[model samples]
Target chain A: MSIGLKKARAVIRATLSKGREMGLSPLSVVVLDPGGHVVAFEREDGAAPGRFAIAHGKAFGAVMLGMPGSAQMARAEGQAYFMGAMNGLFGGQVVPVPGGVLMRDGRGRLAGAVGVTGDTSENDAEAAVAGVEAAKLVAEA
Target chain B: MSIGLKKARAVIRATLSKGREMGLSPLSVVVLDPGGHVVAFEREDGAAPGRFAIAHGKAFGAVMLGMPGSAQMARAEGQAYFMGAMNGLFGGQVVPVPGGVLMRDGRGRLAGAVGVTGDTSENDAEAAVAGVEAAKLVAEA
Candidate 1:
């Protein structure tokens, strides 16, 4: 019922492969289970050193809030202080960006999340969506 | 070459399975690539709430220092101030304990690290070593 390791790796592989095919910068992708613990992760060959942590933060944020990163951004728009406090409390694990997407199971229950980092936020989000679809799950972004 | 997501997940699964067989507490495991980036992670169903971060910190500490967590503990034995400074600088990501083990490639080159939590330090380290060996890698601890 949950997003297990096999599916998480599928999502990561799909996201990175799509990034390569689209000529985007090398990427780092992270998958997090519903409890915000890492499930699987990968950093493409040429990804920047910082991309791994960023991707993890984005995915953790999505899973922790039970929403897509884009929605978290929207919710933080007028509550900068609250968002900042939350980030501080979690040791800066929350990333308000478009790269994080919530994944749902066949029954529409929140399963986990995927986060991609390397290029623009929009591109990252696109890759995350592709990853979700590749894993045969629904992406809520 | 690098510790890919597949190998990382393999290590985690091996470790958790062993833990269950040994009747240890539910565990959280983490694998990190040479660059100190997460490769894969898992938290067992009944693992304590704080185990995820502790597992990650232990693995990250091993990779960042290029040594086993026990070695880091030894080095920090008489350098409390220095270790404290390092922890402060890295936002407390370093965990000096026996649960972290450095991984080596076939050629004995440093590859990454595996860390396990939710049991006694010795038991955690034992699990990590078993995990690394299960993945057909070397555990230098």
Candidate 2:
């Protein structure tokens, strides 16, 4: 089953609201389908200019690589040349950050991913997980 | 005067609904903020593989160039070299096509842009304009 845009937007909204409640800096959130296509995206007011791009990249990476951003970073460890080549091939769409989290359906099928940017990477990942949970989906970080 | 995600999503939904009513093929729509950042995006099921990227590129071009995609295509006529250079400079983020349209607020300020893909260019542009109108915004094309 595919993740619909409504669900994606719900995830994004939940993530941004959680970020705000935590008194974090402004955030940008992006949700991508399993095919690495954007389902929903939002940049909160006062977010930095580059936040949206970074958020999108993280989410795209998670979906395209079939791994959470943190795990991707871990796998890319000590492989700077490989990472560089991957980035070059994908036009820098892969971000090795902690903000990307994979989503799965109740049947353990891949749904998509959510990415958040702004504040610390850990906090961003936390918010993304919170969003997936809020959407009643499983977040695989 | 930036277009918020809520409004952008509304526009996208309206466009998709209209496309459905018209019996058009599955579509992918994208909305970009004034700064050329994605505000919202959606791809209907069954949409062709590259539709999302094409929709995004068209919307980004509209917002960054301050004109509709059709106009951009017109201006690019007899300027293949310039258009090529621009695409190279922007990393292929710009698409000169008929489906991209500019959005303006009631106060005549630049708001954002909407782009549609997966149908005839004329139908795509029509759907985009209908979406902006449904949102009570101006569609400049």
Candidate 3:
């Protein structure tokens, strides 16, 4: 968990820095434990008020479902009902949209997850994946 | 973990049955693993929003500290930083509120924990304790 927090801090710092460099507004970053509980959170200046909850939920869903939230959204064809039902199943703790990515270990095992929000879904997902890669943590399934 | 969830649900059902006889609103119940991961949760209609999260954190703190949440709250009064520090350390995953209780096993050892919300803290605590008891589990220390 501690490693998740530390590595997540760097991830958030790097990703958010990139967003800023691209003239993107401030953002919120959330990290979840292996069991999908919040490990750390950072809300940048001027980030949307709802980003905290939304980002956390997306990140949570990422690890809970063992996939990228964006990829899940992209792949949904007939199983959309399953995605819709998850919010209720998780007690509203899950967001099926993309923008969150799972963290992995050297052996390509799931370690934790990270989420980024405050921009388009693609932007958020990219930021999260970038963060994971920057930390050298594998995001293998 | 399964046993903890089973006991937690049974405790909540019994407590709520009693509450109905006494004329109370619906309740929400939660159970946690020794490591603070949620084992299970149930929310009766009309329970307050996000009760499960609070209950989970409380139960987790009880297991980690080997005491009830209320007692922890009492101690926090003098220690002040204890509760907040734990919440921060756990990234807000350990709450010292009153709705959490501990679970024990046949050998009188802690097996896990339970938490209840959506009612008075006293009722929540009672329900949590009752759930563990209904599981035929004992609480020693």
Number of the top-ranking candidate, with TM-score as the measure: 2
TM of chain B vs. native, candidate 3: 0.83
Native contact share for candidate 1: 0.24
Indicate the worst ten consecutive residues by lDDT in candidate 2 chain B: B40-49
Q: Rank order by lDDT, top first?
A: 2, 1, 3
- Candidates in order have lDDT scores of 0.83, 0.85, 0.67
Residue B26 lDDT, candidate 3, scale 0-100: 69
Give the best candidate by DockQ: 2
Query: TM-score for all predictions?
Result: 0.75, 0.87, 0.51
Best by lDDT: 2
Predictions in order: chain A TM-score: 0.94, 0.95, 0.88
TM for candidate 2 is 0.87
Give Cα distance to truth, residue B29, candidate 2, Å.
1.9
Tens digit of per-residue lDDT, candidate 1, span A6-92: 788789889988887888997888888888767666776556668768998898888877778898888789788887887898889
- Provide the clashing-pair count of each candidate structure: 0, 0, 3
Q: Output the lDDT of residue A81, model 1.
A: 84
Q: DockQ of each model against the real complex?
A: 0.29, 0.48, 0.03
